[model samples]
Target: MKLDFNLKLTQEQRLVMTQQMQLSVKMLQMSGFELQEYIGKEVEENPVLDAEYDTNSNLKEKNNEIDYKKFIEYLNFDNYSGKNYYRNEEETVSPFTFISNKKSLKDYLNEQIIEVNEGEYTKEICKYIVENLDNRGYLDNTVENICEEIEAKKDDVEYALKVVQSLEPDGIACGDLKECLKIQLNKKGIKDENLFGLIDDCLELLANNKLGEISKKLKIKKSEVQRYVDFIRTLEPKPARGFYTGENVKYIAPDAYIRKIDGEYHIIMNDDILPKLKISPLYKNIVSSENNDNDNDTADYVKKKINNAMFLIKSIQHRKSTIYRVLEQIIDLQRDYFDYGKEYLKPMTLKEISYRIDMHESTVSRAIRDKYIYTNKGIVKIKDLFTVGISSQAYGDDISTIKIKNKIKECIESEDKKKPLSDQKICDILKKEDMNISRRTVAKYREELGIKSSSKRKRF
Candidate 1:
């Protein structure tokens, strides 16, 4: 063996960082709302930077004419105190306050439990249980385990568990599916031995809507089994009642709006959220007029401040134009998806769009990060349309992985429940439909769609 200590490099590439480069990337990832907050903070910190808002500024100055009307319509008119509007209409008006008032699942449950009849020890145990519940409202720890940890008697824990179960959110405080179902059934006054046995013994099959097997095992008719199943289906699976408080409602303010006008899709950037920023003419004249004075230090200081202000304004303009260009390209590429739906979304990659738009792949990726587009359909995240492609069998054409997953879902929905399709069978079915996917690919797509295997999906 030969050992060499000398090293040589043929060629190398390196990235150099600058203030502008760092700011560009940071600005790209921020949404419209986040960017507004960031700009406000920057203005407060940097004396050289200033932001001014004018309600009378024409929105059409930045956006195209067609989109200007649609954007204004979305804004909607509201009457102020001076306007001669009806008093009853005041209740329907929405203010610009963006604060959210929402309580989490556990917090809501705890509040209710505190008001219930229970001893001090039992209430403490119940509080512990509520704190340990999973997001889906299932108790993560067993009662026995909790009793052992707390050094409390099993009866005390059991009493607390019962009280917790009786709280408003139906199936909470239970450890597993069996306990959840038993609590729900007990609340509904269902005490039939056959119904309890069916639930405890064959809940797996029961959940799959397999009425026949449950009927034969319990010596009951299929109609009776279905009636119970119908009742069970009405029960809420997630017992965390406060989970859907709408606290984390994500309001999307799109960067652009694309509309169909005269058989052509017109793209317009939404600059309503963006305040028109420019160097104050009065301030600029002050600096320029004092440049020839004897005080060199003052002149230099003014020049530096004016330059910083100009740079800040220019950055805002560049950011807006870059976002607008990127949105236009996305609208052009996803024209079919906007007209139709997700099914028509063609497979697109960052590199493809980057090349088309004469920007780097990283730049394009940053441009679309957290950005949104308002279309005729609704507000859609700009990044949601891109997906990896899988090749088809005939003519070797490629289809999107998302499309293949949708097809798999459709096949499962329409498949006969008596004989659920296996992974290989699903692959064959997809092959016939021109999606040349393998069994592994089928399993991957199935798992991604949250569909279980044939055995798990079987209807008994």
Candidate 2:
């Protein structure tokens, strides 16, 4: 082995973190509500940065609204194809608003319990149980455990559980699945040991729609087992309806709205969420004009503050433009998805879009984080439209894993319950349909879709 001490020169590309990169990531992950909070914080912290709002000014005006149609018309047709001339319209413009009122899980539960008619002791026990309930509405402590903690009798805790269970939605205070079901079943006058035993023994089977196993175990007919299964299916798995109550829902406001107009889709970036920010002209002029020895330190300080303010303004502008560009790339790649919904969502990777948009994969990933798009269909998480692709048997055509999973769901739905399609059979069907998916893929897809295998799905 010869050791060469010769130096070799090579050129390599590297990514450096810039203010634009930092701002891009922040903008991507921030929802409208989060962005509002962030800007408010920034305005408070950055003395030079201030917000100017004109109540009469529309979002378009504040954004220096571009005439999309006129802009597109001015573009040379020879340089771009119909596909390249995509235009997106604004969907809706509304002021950024946030929910100032938020109740903790404990507070929400206590408020509901307060309305119920109960003795002081029972109320105290209920409060203890409510405090111990997990976010999923399951009681984190056993009745005995809670009784010991609160220095109350076990019977008193049990009575409190009964009161909580009897409250709206039937099963709120349960510690586990069995107790939750048992509470609901007891209320329905189903106390028979054999029937209850059937449920306990076959809940796994029952959940997968396997009534036949239950029937055979109980020495009853398939029809009898199905009757019980159907009854159980109606039971609420989530015991806390009140805790999860938000009927008239408000979702995150999208930073951009993509719309289809005259057979073309256009992109409109919503800058309304961002407060109007600029350096104070009066202060800037004063600082620039005062070239005196006595005001050196003051001038330097003012200049530094002004520079920081300008940087912040530029950061926000760059953030908006970067988000718009990233969204444009997403719209181009996921045109079918936006046009036709989830079924048409092609399998797309971050790298592919990043490459197309001349951005780093990580940049693209961050650019889409927690971002949303408001469209004719509704507000959809931008990231939801991009998924891993599953290749089809036919070369040049790839199917999204989501699509294959949906096909499997359809096959199962159309299958006779007595003879549900086996995983291998499902694969065969997909093959016949030219999807060319293997049995393993089919099984994986089935499981992902929460569809059980043939044996599990078989009814009596």
Candidate 3:
């Protein structure tokens, strides 16, 4: 075989994202509070970017044109009122940031330990027990192990265990789920032998609804076992459910609001709380200078910064406008929902809104990403406007999946506790209401709402 070397020339057109375009896309996805934080960093890095405060209503319900430059002085601090950073003076700390005075789980237990009026050695043992509690309010160490560690007798350790377990929250310092249930039961003065036996030896059977086995073994009626299980459902496994989670509480500010003016609905951007961004006159003057063209690097550096600043300003404007238009379209489509209640919420999708507004679906997605708007129904995320719908043989738009799920939750909440409604029964109930959905979908929606099935929901 003969081999020949040849080179072929081919050309193709392709679209590439530039640095400015990338920044614009990134800014488009940032929320209102996140944009403020990003702008703060940008002000520190770029000398050409300047900010000002706009003395207007942070929440405006009027229809007015958004003048981004109206912001002259940025008074963005909300939680730190007494702190002085703009002027040279003493730094006044905020009381909300003082975490030392707050009581932790261990601190709370120790206070109760001191009130016990027990012996010094016993109190010390209880203190050790309290300190050894895990974040879930469970004692990870056994009494025997604690006794060996402190060189104390087993009786003292057992007493300390009981003392620590007697603290509030009903189940603190408990070693396991069984002990936790017993402690909470003790607090409620519940001493049913059937309930105690269920916790100790038949928890698995109880969960699977084999109460017949429990009734036979414990010599208690099946109805009584069912009643005990129902009570157990009310107790929490993790006693410290709402303790300090070591995370700052995030505060959200809606980016836009829907207002009614003389029986008209309008979508307006929330630009008052945001810091106003504009190019510095000093750098602008330098960039527009024609005579000082001797140095290329300096001119290039200034021009690059100027272009970046302008693109950033334009990107922010685009973000606000895009969000405003999205809210406008959503309000148009789901008008009945906003005017009435969630029951009127229709089936909607990003594709539908994007097609109506002549925008790419991804663009619409980015515009509503982590964005919120204030309606008469209070503040709601823009993403919630896009919901899956279930079509039925009825008038009006398709019923939203959110509405269906909410209805399922209502059915379960109001159902007879002795014989809870099954998924098929719930489907029939919805059919009577003109809602056509399958039993599998009902079960799926039930699970999404954090609800168990009829068997698990059964009570006596």
Candidate 4:
């Protein structure tokens, strides 16, 4: 082989985002409070910029009158579909989760394991073992490895593990998926050696639904293997399912206000949080005097500062105008959502909005992202207005994903716990309504809506 070198030329189109444009986009994306904090810093650092506080006089007490519980029940449609939710008159504040308070599986398991009346030293070793369990409650370290780590005997570790595995949820501590299921099944008085062998020996085969091969290997009937599979399915694979890594709530300050006044909806940009900005008269005088006296260097410096201050003010105004225009378009398009609720929200996209407003898609994205608008429903993120569309066969139009997800959630909510609806059945129901979609697509949408599979949702 020989080395060779050649020069090549190619032509391509590329879009370059400039610093000022990037700053403009950044300003567009920030919430009212966030923008205020950011601008405060800029005003302090720049000598030519100053602000006049207390700009908003139209602020009203109506912002405080939102029914928090009814709002929650509306948002959590999965739990409260067609169910009347009432707020407690005794409570004064919103019940939204503002902090992460849920106990992790590791911590929850450790608390129970330590109460087993085991020796203090040995329990300490057990604590180490519990700490090593992953989010799925599967032991990440082997018994031998944990024993070595804690400088304890292998028997002590094994006994500790047994104590933990005996706890609630039936399968708290295990080394693998097979062990977890077997432990739970054993607790149920299930003594099938073939079933245990199937879990330990061919777990992968079971997962892929290869019942014929397992039946032949265990010398059991195919239906018998399937029956065992169903039993195994009942056992929890993820012991830490309900307990999560915890979540916190976010507080939003809307940058725009939209509401109907005398049967006409009005859109107003929020100028309260952001201070009223202007160029400092003192700095402008300095620039003018320096230029008149022919002090070239000082004049240039002052002029440069004044120009920067002027540009920032203009950029900020431009960002506000663009956002207001975008919200106007959103209100015009998703008027149904405002008039009704989330269910009436029409399908839309940043690209579609960009085309309609004759702006770049990226600009439209930045203008709406992380920004909120105040309406009758309280504060909502502007980005939530844009949703992808699914085609409708009956109306020959595109239906919003929000609408489909809501329907799927409502269907699941109304389902009988003993006879849950399958994805295929859900698809058939949709088709009868002339909204044709595939079973797999239905399954995908169901998962997106956080609805579990029919088998998992079945009640005893």
Report the Cα RMSD per candidate.
7.4, 8.3, 7.7, 8.2
**Candidate 1 lDDT by residue in tens digits, 261-351:** 8988877777767665555566566667845577767667767767766766677677778878877776787777878888878888999
**In model 4, which regions exceed 4 Å deviation?**
1-18, 29-102, 167-170, 186-234, 244-316, 341-352, 370-460
lDDT (CA) for every model shown?
0.76, 0.74, 0.80, 0.77
**Candidate 4 Cα deviation (angstroms), residue 339:** 3.1
Candidate number with greatest TM-score: 3
Could you say which candidate leads in lDDT?
A: 3
Q: Which residue pairs clash in candidate 3?
A: 52-72, 52-73, 53-72, 53-73, 53-74
TM-scores, one per candidate: 0.71, 0.75, 0.81, 0.62
Model 2 lDDT per residue over 1-460, tens place: 9988988999999989787567656765666668778778877876666688555332223367766554454343212236654432322322343435545556766877898888888988888887777766788888777767778888888888887777655667787887788888888888777668866787887766666667788888888887777677788777765454444455466887787889888888867666788777767775878455678887778788887777767766766777788878778888888788889888889888888879788877777788787787667788887788767657466888778888899999999987788999888988887888678888887787877688777765
Q: Which stretches of candidate 1 lie over 4 Å from their true place?
A: 1-15, 53-93, 96-164, 173-178, 192-234, 242-248, 280-286, 289-305, 390-397
- Residue 278 CA displacement from its true place in model 1, Å: 3.0
Global CA lDDT computed for model 1: 0.76
lDDT by residue (tens digit), candidate 3, 1-460: 9999999999999989987788888889988878888988988898888988575553333467554433222232221124643421111233466767556777777888889868888889988997788888999888888878989899878987887788787899998989998999999998877688889999888787777787898888888887777788899888877776445756567787677778779876778658888888987777778866687677788788888788888988898888878887888888888888788888888899889889999989999999887776667888887889877767555788988898899999999987899999999999998889889989999998999889877765
lDDT of 4: 0.77
Model 3 poorest 10 in a row by lDDT = 71-80
